[model samples]
Target: MGNAIELYDWNVYAIFAPFFAAQFFNLKHPVSALLATYAVFAVAFVMRPIGGFLFGWLADRHGRRMSMLLSVGLASAGSLLIGLAPTYSSVGLTASVVLVLARLIQGLAYGGEIASSHTYIAEVAPAPRRGLWSSIICISSMSALLVATLLGATLSTVLAKQQMVGWGWRVPFVVGGVLGIVALVLRRTLSETNAYEQARTERQTGSRPSMMRGIWQNRIAGLRVIGLVVGGTVFFYTWLVAAPAYAITVKHIPAPEALWSGVIATSVMIVVLPFAGALSDRIGRRPNFVFFTLAAAALSFPLNRLIQNKAWQLTLAMTIAGVTIALVVSILPAVLAELFPTHVRAAGIGVPYSLAVALCGGTAPLLQTWLATSGRGDLFIGYSVVLLLIGTVVVLAMPETKAKPLE
Candidate 1:
């Protein structure tokens, strides 16, 4: 439930990009409006690093349970604000401001939520099956995305184009806000991780956990997080955001078809995620990371070309890519958590992971659309390959942490 609430707003925005793009931006061309909307999306990410630091600090110093509760509430507030914001037609530039502010708040909440939640799970799950248990994070995220896409498909199928553009876009945000409430209620039952409690007691008695000291001590782990995250986040947002946006806008597929394609692809990925997590538990995280990077780097461009040729090809490409990426995403919680000890686990993971995601992940949709618009879409393919290659190197150098004891 906590994971679902953390990601609900993100998937909501990605799925409804087109409808809300028009509502938020009063541009002449649809593409220009989309770029504007994506620009706001990217801009909101600038706050992620700050959010990571603030929330990571809270988890590290106070408790993971409290941090999760606060982040979810903030996320719900942000979604509600976006749902209630005036359209450009109603309030002109003020509408854009409201939209941007709402996104910023969501970005902040998600940064903290991801780090804290992953840390919490890592500490609670059994040592031998940490990978499988931690994979629940990705499963939750994929489920949220699936729900968002299905909702979009349903709404687009039912509403006329004009009706969809008018008000249908707001429904998902309102729904996400409600889901957040459910997650909040569920999270109230969470207990503090024993690892964190032990660390906190130790700190209060004699030694205190310092964020700076933790980073300096685990600086190499921090760098590894950034390196691995670049490819992971870029590829993720590419498949998750750019592909569907391109299909609907550039390919001129009906909105319902495009949205349904997304639903099918993401649902397949969701099923694949836990299996990948279990596989990581069996074989180790490094091999899975290496396989995903090498395969994605080699196949992504060709698969992208195939997607441009046919709708079925689009579904196939997204599904394959989504599943492949799930291998990495599923194990990421365990891998990142294993890199740092409990004293700095949340902050160490949060800062580097959030920074990489903010810098690479958040801007992907805008960058891909702009590159495609400029008739250099192929560059995006090369961009993914380059990032993957870097990730391959990082994975190759990093030590395996499967079932490693949490510090």
Candidate 2:
């Protein structure tokens, strides 16, 4: 439930970027307006590392349950604020400011939410089957995207264009806000992890656990996280956010068709994620990461080019990318949790994960749009390949953590 709510909160941004662009940005051209809005989306990510460290410290020192509760509340408020915010016509620049502010709060909440939720779930899972259970976090997030895209597609289908542009876009944000509250209520009943409790009880005499120091001391592990996340984040946003937008904006595909394609692709991922996780449990984490990174490097360009002219091709390409990406995302939480001691697991995961995601994931959509518009789409493909190559090198160097005991 916490995963569901957190992901819904995060995904609402991508699913509604077009509507927000129309409402908040006052540019003359539609493309310009969208770029500006997506720029705001990237800007919000600047807050994520700070949020990660802050809530990570709270979780490390106090409890994961408390951090989860607080993060959800923050996200809920941000969603509600965005839903209730006035349009540019009514409030002018203030509306855009409000939008940026709302996104910042949401970024902060989601940054923390990811770490706490990942740590909590990984700690509770059985040692041998941890990959299967940990994959649920990413699956829940993908499912949220599926739900949001389906709803957006349905709304576009039913509402007239003017009606959708005018008021229909607010519905999902409002609904997400309510769902966040429900998640908060559900999270309150969550029990503290025995791992954390045991770690606390067995603390070495005079050995203080410092979040910042822990991350710095675990610098090698932290860098591994950054490597994994950089390519993963870009792939995720490209498939989930940029692809749909590119189809609608560049290919001139109808909005409903583009969104429905995303819905279908995301639904496929929802099924594929668990299988990938289980496969990692059997084969090992390093092999899957290496395979996924190499596959992404090899396939990204041709497959991306394959989708350019038609909606069906776009759907097929995204679905393929989704399946490949699922292999990495499904096992990532367990792998990350296994990298650090229980005393600093959340902080360890949160710091580098948030940093890489903020730097890479958040900027992906804006970067893709800019590159495409500048007629250097080939360069963007090269850029993606380079990142994947870096990830492949790192994964090859890092030791496999399959069925490893969480210290």
Candidate 3:
């Protein structure tokens, strides 16, 4: 439920990127307006690491349940603010300022929610079936994207363009806010993990300091997380969000067709996600990680070119990419959770993962746009390849986590 609510809030903004750009920027040039909107979107990701560190600390010192509740509360507030925000015509620069602020809060909440929730779920699950249980987090998030895409499509089809830009975009935000409240209520009933309880009971004094000391001692684990996540984040945001926008705006594909292509691809990913995790459980995590990273590196260019062909071709290409993405995303939670002791697992995952996300995922759209506009679309492909190569190297160097306990 928490995963669903988080993805709902995150994808709502992404699905309505075009509408927001037109409504908020007041620019005559469509690409310029979209770029401006994406810039603001990237700025929100800048706050993720801070939120990760802050709430991760809270989760370690206080409790995971409390940290999750706080994250949902902040997401709810941000969604409501976005729903009620005025357009540029009515409020000038203040409207944009408010929009960015809302996104910052949303991003921060998102940063904390996934890391803490993943840690909680991984800790609670049995050792052997941990991969299967952790896969549900990604499944829930992908399901939320499916909902967002369907809602966006329905609204886009029913409302006239003017109405969509002016008011229809608010519907998703309002729905997201309500869903966040529901998630908060559901999360309140969850029991704290035994890992946290055991850690607390075992320690006599200065536990917080001990946890910090442990994190500092295992610095290599954090670096491994950064290396593993960088390529995955870049691939995800570029292929899913930025590519769709590029297809519509630059390639002149029909908006509905492009969106439907993504919708179909995401649906395929949701189905395959758990299977990939199960495969990792059987075969081992390192092999799957190495395969997907290499596949992403080799396929990035061809996939981009295929998507530029026709609608059906684009859908086919996206489906393949989606499968690769699913394989990577499904096992990551379990792998990261096993990297640290129970004392600081939340921070261990959140801080470094958030940093990698900020450095790679956050800038994906802007970098893609710049590359496309500069007549260097191949450069974007190169960038993805380089990241994947780095990730594959790190994955090979790091120890496999399939046999490890959560703590």
Candidate 4:
């Protein structure tokens, strides 16, 4: 729940950005305002690597429980700040600055949450069932995403256009703030896992180096994490995060219909994630990633071609993309956590994973929008296919760890 709530805080901004972009930005045109908003969104993502390092070290050295507690508190505070922030009409440029600051805080919290939660979940699940258990991470994430989409659909349906742009845009941030507190309260009940306990014991015995040194030592594994993440993250943000906005703004779909299409596609993701994870358990981690990358590459062109101005077209494109996404993300936490020893698991995964996502996933939406506006949407599809193929190569090169015990 805590994990889910933080992600909601992270993503709710994207769903509502089109409504609020003009509020904070002083751009002349709506398109310019939207672009500026996404630039700020990208700026927040750039902070993820720094946050990942800070919190990942804390988790590795302190405890995952404590790191998580701190992260959620920060996330809630950020959400509240955004909810209460003044608009440009009242505060001028300060409003935009406030939004940036708040986004930075949430980015840090999100980076921390990813590191700690993935390590925690991977450590606690029984070895044989780790793949299946890891599905909970993305399940929680996608569930949060689904709620934000539904909320968007609901607000778009019931609220007048003026109402949405005026005050309705801020409602989700406030709701996320409240949810964060609830998640914090719930997370308090969680205990440290046996793996972390064991790792902590070893640390006291002087079995580990400084966090920086440890991360450096495992840099090769870190690079692999980047390679594995870059392609998948691009594919993910393109179809899932940016689809609705692209359809509404570019393809000229109705706002409510665009949002509803996201609701449907994300619902499909939530359902398939667990089954994909279980499949990885039955076969191997490599096969799921291999298949996902190859399938994503193979389908990118045709699926993109299917998208049109209609909501159904957008829904169909995204639904297909969602299924392919599940095959990689459902077992991704397990794969990432397994790459390093417990001593540096959180930091090792955090630094590189966040870096990859910040670079590739963060820019994906803006890049796609720019290309589409330039009459080069097909080029972006080709770009995605190339990235997925690269990811496939990386997956094939990496060792299969399905049956290996976590160090």
Q: lDDT per model, in order? A: 0.88, 0.87, 0.85, 0.90
Model 1 weakest lDDT span, ten residues long: 304-313
Residues 22-129 of candidate 3 have per-residue lDDT tens digits of 777779888898889888888989888888888888888789999999998898889889999988899888899999999999889988986698899889877787
How many Å off is the CA of 401 in candidate 2?
A: 0.7
Clashing pairs in 4: none
Candidate 4 lDDT over 136-186, as tens digits, reads: 999999999999989999999999989999999889899999888898888
* lDDT, residue 56, candidate 1: 91
What does the lDDT come to for candidate 1?
A: 0.88
Model 1 per-residue lDDT tens digits across residues 1-407: 87886687866887788887988877979999999988988987888888788899999998999889989999988998999899889899999999999999998999898779989999999988999998899888888888888899899999998988888888999988888889989999999999999998889898864798888888999999999999878898888656777788777777888888888999999888889999999999998999999999988788778766356877888898898898899988899999998989998998899899999999888888898879898998899799999999999998889999997
Candidates sorted on lDDT, descending: 4, 1, 2, 3
Query: Per-residue lDDT of 359-389 in model 2, one digit per residue for the tens?
Result: 9888888888888878887787888888888
The count of backbone overlaps in candidate 4 is 0
For candidate 2, which ten residues in a row score worst on lDDT?
200-209
Best by lDDT: 4
- Candidate 2 stretches with Cα past 4 Å from truth are 204-206
Q: Clash totals for all models, in order? A: 0, 0, 0, 0
